[model samples]
Target: MKRNTNYYIRKAHRYLGLFLGIQFLFWTLGGLYFSWSDIDKIHGEHLVMEKKDFSTTSGLIAPDSILIKINSRQPLTPIAKIELVETLGEPYYQLQLMTGEYRLFSAKTGHLKPQFTKDEVIEIARTYITFEAEVKETELLTIVSNHHEYRERHLPVWAIAFDYEGDPVVYVDAVTGQFERIRHNSWRVFDWLWMMHTMDYETRDNFGNWLLKAFSILGLITVLSGFLLFGVSYNKREFKFLKIKKS
Candidate 1:
């Protein structure tokens, strides 16, 4: 059995196909899911209530009072942003310090607030949901892995899980007393498919990885070898016979 370039190329194409077929299938599946799925729904837009307007905050204390109060406690701490935000239908001053620290102050009393209590966070989560659902689980997310859904978000958030249709979860900023994110089963499915599309199992967002690169190279070679095989097997005698008959 003498092995030639044709045989080797065909063999390489076959094995490469066997190896990369799964990844290709995953890429196609992920692509189809992503394209067909509504982006807003994937982000759990339909799960949460509509945003409430805080324009009628005439009774709230001025932000200057909150700034003065903050200066007394955290002296010399430079603030990056400040806004009068609402929590549980009450007004609160959200302060983001340049040091990446967040603090909340009572807009009615100008009192510095501690981190939102568990009960407060739960109520905040409840206020954001449009439907009536009982709480399933509540967790304080202080630590998480890189692949976690709430990763890279504000730390020490309150994760309030609900006994809803999608097992939906709402994260509240423990410090700023704001709703951080809403995650549901639909989002989880989207995330999983995104991981496959990117070929990243760990971070799930990295599109350039060694494993993906290797498979991509093998896939390219498989295509190139298939073309070469076709060229090698082409019989020019058939074309010559046709041309002679036409002449």
Candidate 2:
């Protein structure tokens, strides 16, 4: 019975190790990277420009002017919030409707500026960065390209790539003219590692997938079998030592 149990334990341990060893190594390496990597750097905070507070001083355009312009164009929706924001030193009135629609108007002229053109997006990208460089390329993404990084963000974004050292890319909301996120080489590598660690290829965030569960069970079996074999070996050696001492 002992020999039969040992045989089964050895077989299970060896096969489980063969099947899940590389994944174990990946989990360790990815975990170490996540633990040591600076979360701010991973978010590419160092590549983008900081937001400057909008001035609330006099000479600013009145809120009524913006409301009049918007109400004249279309039927009124219940307003949730209205605020003044500046991009590239130009002031604009951002209106949020309770229906989840956003509108932007030029605070100076009260003209409706719904969407940003490619030139305007490039200018915004340049203003968002501290360094001086023309936009290298601009691609309009109708849908989120990578769901892992840009999950839950609004669609129809502008991917503006810069000709900087790390080849930084900024994703801006085309409709709202908001800076969605910044991505670079480090972020890409970190994202790939995260996907591997989570083992969720489709979403890259689900941790309770079947593959992970199966592997976890196999890993537990491997560890328990190893401990059982160690205990068995220790007992056999001690039995032999006792017999020798008695003789």
**Clashes per model (N, Cα, C within 3 A):** 0, 0
- Candidate 2: which stretches are off by over 4 Å? 55-57, 145-149, 238-247
Candidate 1 residue lDDT tens string, 1-247:
3338768878888888898888899989989888999999899888788889985687788898767766777684788998888877778888888988888888889887888888999988887888788899999889989778887888889999999998899999988889989999889988888888878889887778998888888888889988887787565557888899999
Best by TM-score: 1
Q: Score every model by TM-score.
A: 0.89, 0.86
RMSD of every candidate to native, in Å, equals: 3.4, 2.7
Per-residue lDDT of candidate 2, residues 97-125 (tens digit) = 89877877788888778688788888787
**Candidate 2 worst ten-residue window by lDDT:** 143-152
Model 1, global lDDT: 0.85
Return the lDDT, model 1, position 75: 83
lDDT, candidate 2, at 199: 83
